[model samples]
Every structure is written in C-alpha cells, then in structure tokens.
Target: MGVASKLKDGFLSAFCLFLIGGAGFVVNVGQLLALVILPFDRHLFRSISTWLGSGFMIAGPFLLEDWGGCKFSAYGEQAPPDSKVLIVVNHGTDMDWAGGLSYLARLGEPFPGGAKAIAKDTLMYIPIFGWLTYFLEFMYVKRDWESDKKTLTKQANQLGTSRLPFYLCLFPEGTRKTPKKHAQSQEFCKKNGYPVLNNLLYPRFKAFTLIAMTMRDQIDGVIDATFAFEGEHPNMSKSLSRKLSCRCNLICQYHPMNELPEGEEELEEWLRNTWVKKDALLDEVLKDQEAFCSKQRKYEWKQEPLDYTKFFALVGVFCFFLVGLSVLMIVNKIIRRGVLVISVITWVAVVAALVINIRPSKVGEKKPDPETSSRRKKAD
Candidate 1:
C-alpha cells in the first residue's frame, strides 16, 4: 500500500471509530432515560436491550462486508428464528465474531432478544464499546470458578426464565488462536488425556457445562460454528483501506441441548468429543482451501450478492438519532448537563459491576480438576 493510501485509511478508520463511539454514548444515555421512566420487566428490558445492542453490533459487520468488500459463504441448516440458542464458535481472529452479525442478518428475522455474549471480564474496561454494551447487558465472566459461578448462575437463572428468544454466544477457547496458546493447549490436552487440536485451542468446557445444565430446558439447541478466512484476515485498518480481498467460510451444526448427556463428567466428555469433531471439521475446511477447487463439495459455498439496502437503512437511523440528539442538546442546557450526569452514572455502575461480589452459588458447580481446584480455592 502507498504511504498516501495508508494515511487515508488511518484517517477514515479513526473517524469511523470516533463517530460510532460518540453516538453509542449518546444512545446509551437515552437508554438510561428510558429505563427510568418505563415499568420494569426483566424479560421486556432484556429484549429491548438486546435489540438496541444488535443495532450497534451491525456497525462492525457493515464495515467489513459492505465497505471493505469482504465475502462470506456459510453452510449448515439455519437455526429456527425466534428460538433461544447457544452458539459455540471457534475464535480465529478478533474479528471472527463480528462476521457473525452479517451471517445472522442474512438468515432472516433476528431472535426477539437478539444476542448476548459471554465476554471476558476485562472487556468491561474498554471505553465506549464497554460503556454502551453495559446497558445492553452482555454477560461477563472472570474465568475463575469461584468468581464466575455466582455471576453465571444468577445470569443463567434469569436467562432460563426468559420467554424471549435470544442467542447466547460463547467462545469456549476463551482467547483467540496464537502459536503460544495453541502449543500450551496441546500440552494441556495431552497431559489431561483430552483430544488435542491442531488448528484450535482446547475449549474451557466447565463454564459451558454449567450454563448448559442451568438452562437445559429453556434453550432450543446449540450451534457449533467454525469460521475460515481464505486470505488476509481484515482488521480495522485492512478493512478501512479495502486492501485485502477476504472471503470467510463458515460451517455450522445444531445440537439439541436436551439430547446432551446429563452428568457433569459426561457432559464435559461430550463437549470434548464435540471439539474433536470440530477439529477434524476444520481440518476439512483448511484442506479444501489448499486442494482442488472442484473436490467433492460437502458444503456448497454459496456466494449470494450481499444487498446493502438494509445496512444503509440502519446507517440512516443511526445518523438520524445522532442528529436528533445534537438538536436536543443545543436547545436545552439542562439536557446537556443530564448527558454528563448519565456519563458519570455509567462509570459508577461499571465500577460496581466489577468490584461487587455476589453471594456464593447455590447452584451445583462442578468440582474443578484436583490440580486446579486448590488454586481456585486459594483465590476464593
């Protein structure tokens, strides 16, 4: 890329990030106002919050697919619309889950409650994205059983009772793939007698098992999704510059939760066994990319023309909201103060959510492996 083009790309990416972050902050303040005036119902609040989050989530996918000209081809039967589901996906890049928004958008109407992710606890500290999503109520886990159990169980109980349709997305690998993590994962799996994966990390399955057990009867099924990118994986810079011609191939499989094994040990085994299959499935995807294009096509890669009409509509609404907020703030100084107050409140709430410890779990948490249990107990 030329120096001039690189500078242009940097400027555009910065502008987009600034615009989205500022606008999201304004919208979240509005969300706080709505919550204050509206009657409280957990299900109703969650559904509305998820819907709002989904709107912001579209920004990532739109930038990648519409602006950057990335292509996506997906396989497997679509999950039933308006049914609760748990999505178990392999994480390849930071942007992998961002691709999910585009894939789900193309699948038809979204779930009533849209999506809530199981995010690592540290993400809550990120500036604008973190503040905005706090209102959207994404579940955050510390990855420590002692700390995570109370939070997960409380959150799961709420989810289990909700009649609203939603997607609970989990990256069981806990982190994105890297050479060091992959090597450590192989070591962990080999020593523990679990299956070792080459192109993926061994899943941290204890949390998955707990949540699945907690919400077994409530959710419909689980979706195992694997994403493969054919060329350079586009980050924000590559995406803004349109410097890479990227095609992401996604494969999914649906497993009904009720059909899963009952015991914690059995369920953990089931999850491991499932990952073994996913590892081989990824092997197939990588092999296909390296081999003859016309090899027996197990998954017919469909390159449908991506219609930008809906995305444009979403952008229009976003612009309108920002404009309306500008007009309101200009007209009334009190409203401007209210915005600052909302920002302060957001910070306080974030701190509380981070430091406040929930009571010990009444929910039956699976005992950690003997070696790890001692460390967790000490941490507690």
Candidate 2:
C-alpha cells in the first residue's frame, strides 16, 4: 500500500481494463467462428462459450494480479464431479462471482461446466461480451422484483431441461458487499437469537426458494459457500479495489441445500433456518482462524494444463491474438484515429495474453470484517 505500489497498482488496473476489452473483442470473433463452422449444436456452442469465459476468468488473476491473499476452501460433502449444484454465496464485491469461480478452479472443480449465473440484462448489451454470452444462454434478469421472480421460475425450468450439470450462483443480498450490510446481517441474526457466525448481509430469499424448489429434482445439492475475508477491518468491500493486492482468504463450505418443502411458508422457514446454520458455521471459521497457528493448513490447490482439453485451449489463444490485432488496427487506424490512448493500451494487453498464453486463478474479497453490523453498532 505504499505510494509506489499505488502507482504500480493504478498502471496495472488500466492495463487490465485494456486487456479485458481486447479479450472481449477476440472472444466475440471466436464465438462467431464457432457458430458458423461448428455444425449446429446450440448446446455445444453454449458449453464452449462458457468454458472460454472460464478460461478468460482464469487468465484474469495473472494478468491483473489485483487480488491478494486469496483462498477458496470447502466444507460439508464436496459435490460429486459433474453433479448439478445450486450454490449460495455471500456477495462482497462486483468481482465476487468471478472471484468465486476462479476459487472453484483452484479447488479442482470443473468451474465452467457446473457454472451458470443470473446477470443483469443490461450487461448482455455491452458490446462483444453481452451479445456472445446472451447468445450462449446465460440467465438474464430485469432489475424489477416481479420480473426477477418470473425469470427465476423460467431459469429453474431451463435448468431441468438443459441436462448440462449446472450450478446457480446467487448473491441473496442482491448487491455488492459492504461493512454496513455485513453488520446489518449480523444484527438480524443475533436479534433473532440465531447463530451469530452465519453473519452475512441480509439475504432476500424470494427467488432462492423458488429456484431450489424448481430444480430440486435436478440439483444434487445446495452449496452454502460462506466467503470470509481475513483482514484487520470491517469495511473490507467499501474500497474493494484496494484489497486485490493484499492478503485475503475465503472459506467456502458446502452443505446440502435440503429438499424444498411442499408448503410455501414451510419452504421460507426452511431457507431461513438453513441460513441460520450458515451463520454459525461462518462464526466457527472466523474463530478457528483467530486461534489457529500462523502457518495455516493449506487446502487443496491444483492446476492442470489447458491444452489437454479438446481444441479449446489452442483455439482460444488464437482467437485472443487475432482479436487483439484486429482491434488495435481498427482503433488506431479507423475508429478513434489513434486519438484514444485507452484503446491503444488495451490492444497491447490482448497481444500480451496471446504471446504469454498463461492463465492463473483464485476467488473472493481480500479484506477482513472485524464485526458484524450488530456488534459494530454497539461498539460505536
């Protein structure tokens, strides 16, 4: 966090943005090529696009190196490889979902195949990315409440039909992670005399119950991925961009998302109870960290060569390179007439990803919360 480090970090951030944009351009062209040449299986395309996105996700940490002290650990029974899971996680930053996916890759899980997320519709309209992912069949939701409910119902049905093992990652808190929200969550849990460590931002459960009930038959289990960032302060996410380079850890414990009850009221109660236990488990993890040895036990971390996969790794790199060059030329020569320095810088990133052809991964916030809302308010 020194001045030099801050300057270095700023440069890196700008570089990452350029690379992200360049990557998007390349990925778009790649998807288009796949669509035209790869016979006509919509399923195959979706799978490939998803895996491609995962690859981009994997490349992010290395290229950006914004996350510091990042870790992903699991609890309860680990889902069988390729099993469909409904993953419930505490959302802490805009990057939390992506961070979680990267974390999953480290845990030796098939990050892409098992992943499908509910995203805002507006995001789908964002140039290359939004279009390609939308075409590939990611779930898109309107910002309104009623529409989101209907969309959740539809997503459940889609999950049942899609046969591809899928896990839905939802931020029941429905927003970025913040200390105030975390403290509020803690207060709610304590006032109800519920377990204190299941401390999370207040979870809005309307759609959660629906998704669980709809996909009950297909879902192998419900994963409560409690993400805890170990640091010295409670306002971990307020300045989330700052923690990307500091030490951070995430404890993701998976518990069986029990069978959804038949009655609506019972189901709500069931979901609430499930969260209460999650709170306690979160507390247990936090306490253990406080008392544990300096040399913490290293959870499983695995990496494999991407080229082993069917054509994906090779094709993705080629596409990244091609797209980078094309964008650089277009922006420098035709579109911006070389006036936009940002565009020129982004092109360089695409070139780097192609030349290096390396990918690294991890997940979650990089700071610690000192107290939940209930505790913080009292201390003040």
Candidate 3:
C-alpha cells in the first residue's frame, strides 16, 4: 500500500476505535450507577454486568469483522458457557485479545461477562476505562511475586467457589514478544541451561502455578490458544484496518487438569514442554497459514454471527449517555466529577478492605447455627 493509503487507513481505524471506546466509556457510567444493585442482589448485579460489560464488548468483533474485513479461524473444543475454563495464550500482537474475542464468541463463552483477564495494576487508575474494568471483575497485579501472590489468592478464591462459570484468560509469557524481550529471554535461557526458543519467550510459570493449584478442582477445561497472523503481526491500527491482508488463526487445544501431573515441579516441567511445542507450532504456521486455518481437526468452531441488535443497542445506549453526560458534566462539572469520583473511590476502598479482612472458610469446620447463636446470646 502507498503511504497515503496507509495514513488514510490508520486514521479511519483510530476514529472507529475511539467511537467504540467512547460508547464503552459511557456504558461505564451506567455500571457506576448499577453498583446499588450489587449489595442487595447479586443475581441482578450479574445480569446488569452482562450487558454493561460483556454486552458492550460485542462491538469489538463487529468493528473488526464488518469494517476491517478480518476473519479469525478457530479450532478447538471450548467449554460450554456453564463450565469453567482457564485459557493461556501465547500473547503476540497488541490486538491478540481483541481478535481472540471473536473466537470466544464462536465458542459460546461469555465475551467479558464472567470471562476475567489478569490486567496490569496501572489500568485500574485510568479514569473511565479503569473504573469499567474494576466493575467487570478484572484481576490486577503488579508482577511482584510477594504482593501479587496475595492478590491472586484473594481474587481467585471468589471465582473458585462462585456458581457463575468464568473463562479466565492468562498469558504465561507474562508479556508480549518484542525484540528486546526476546533477547532477554534468550539470555535467561542460556544462563539457566534451557533450550532457546525461536518464536516464543520462556514462559513465566509463577502466576499460572498458583492459579492452577487454587482453581484446579473447579476448572473444567485448560486451553492453550496458539495464534498466527498471515503477515507480520499488526497493532490495533493495522489489524483494525485489515492491512497487509492480516489474518489471525487460532488453533486451541484442551487439556484436562486431572490428566496432567498434579505436583508444582511436575507442572513446571509440563509448561516447559508446552512452550517448546508452541514454538514448533508458530514455526510451522509462519511458513504456511493454511497449516492450521484450513487443516482438518477434531473440532471446528464457527464464529457466532454478529449480534446486530445487542451491538447497536449497546452503542446506542452510549451515544445517548454521551450527549446527556456531556451536558451534565459541562453544566455541573464540580458535582459530576465529584460524585463519580467519590462513588468509585469509596466502593473500591470498601471492597479492598473487605477482601483483605475476609477469611476463607476452613475446610470441615462446623458453622454455628444461627438459631443456636441467638439462643446462646439470650441465655447469656
């Protein structure tokens, strides 16, 4: 493509991204208001969340598929929506997660509903987007094992026992692949007497180890999502603009947790071997995209046809909010920002305090009957 065409596509891609993102920001405002339902009725809170969060994310796929003309071919067995999944992807380009959402839509998994991802702690500080993710139940970590271990344990416990089924997506690579990071990975491998990977970084096994052990019994499926693009991996601009004939194909595999060896050391060894396998998969697909996209497989998952009604309704809701909030913020800047900020801050502080203070129920510990407690108090 010529430079002019590239520039035009980039401009258009960015504009569309903002439109969708803007709509999402507006929806976050509604999520903010919906916090009242959370304390009184957990079921209603989840129902509201499905629309405000996951329902809003449906636009991501529509923007890519309808506007950008990108097609994602998915291959694997995905757990039913009612079942629990732990997905570890070989994180590649910037849009990997977004594109994967297209495939998740195909597999009948919740878009971002109960589909929780581990995000950087920094994301929580962003005004609208940050507040939205916090309400969506995203887990944040700073990558320090000391503090992160506690955060993971505390958060995982909530999902571990919930009747709501969730698909927890993780990137064991810890971060995306880049020239500098790849060099570091290579040096670390050499120092540690491990084989160097040509296509993937050495897996960081800490978070995965802890998460897997904690949710092992509840986990229904462990998925490995391997992605390869037809051309050089693209950022949101190129990917959204569908430049370079950029196409993504994901070949996912399901492994039952009980089938794998249960020990931590054994699990680490299994992960080492898994990365070696992913390296080979990447090497294969780089040579031929057809290696996976067109190949026959045990399961062939089709993309769920775009939900135009839900998509437009979500975008429309935001558009409405945009106009209303614009005037409200302008007319009442002090009151608007003050109320929004205080509500979010107080809610976050309270939740953090509760998570820190709450203790997990002890296994096999008998609970005192409520009636008995009341009777004993009366006698006392």
Return the lDDT, model 3, position 62. 65
Give per-model TM-scores: 0.78, 0.68, 0.79
TM-score ranking from best to worst? Answer: 3, 1, 2
What pairs collide in candidate 3? none
**Best candidate according to TM-score:** 3
User: What's the ranking of the predictions by lDDT, best on top?
Assistant: 3, 1, 2
How many clashes show up per model? 0, 15, 0
Which of the two, 1 or 3, has more TM-score? 3
* TM-score winner between candidates 2 and 3: 3
Model 3, 190-242: lDDT tens digits are 99999799998899888888888888888886888888777656465555576
Worst 10 residues of 3 by lDDT: 356-365
Top model number, lDDT:
3
Task: For candidate 2, write residues 266-295 as lDDT tens digits.
Answer: 867766776676667557656776543133
TM-score of 3: 0.79
Candidate 1 local lDDT, 29-113, one digit each (tens): 5566668534657666666566555556666666677677787767776667677888888877756766876676665444212
lDDT of 2 at 241: 39
Better of 1 and 2 by lDDT: 1
Off by over 4 Å in 1: 37-39, 111-113, 290-380
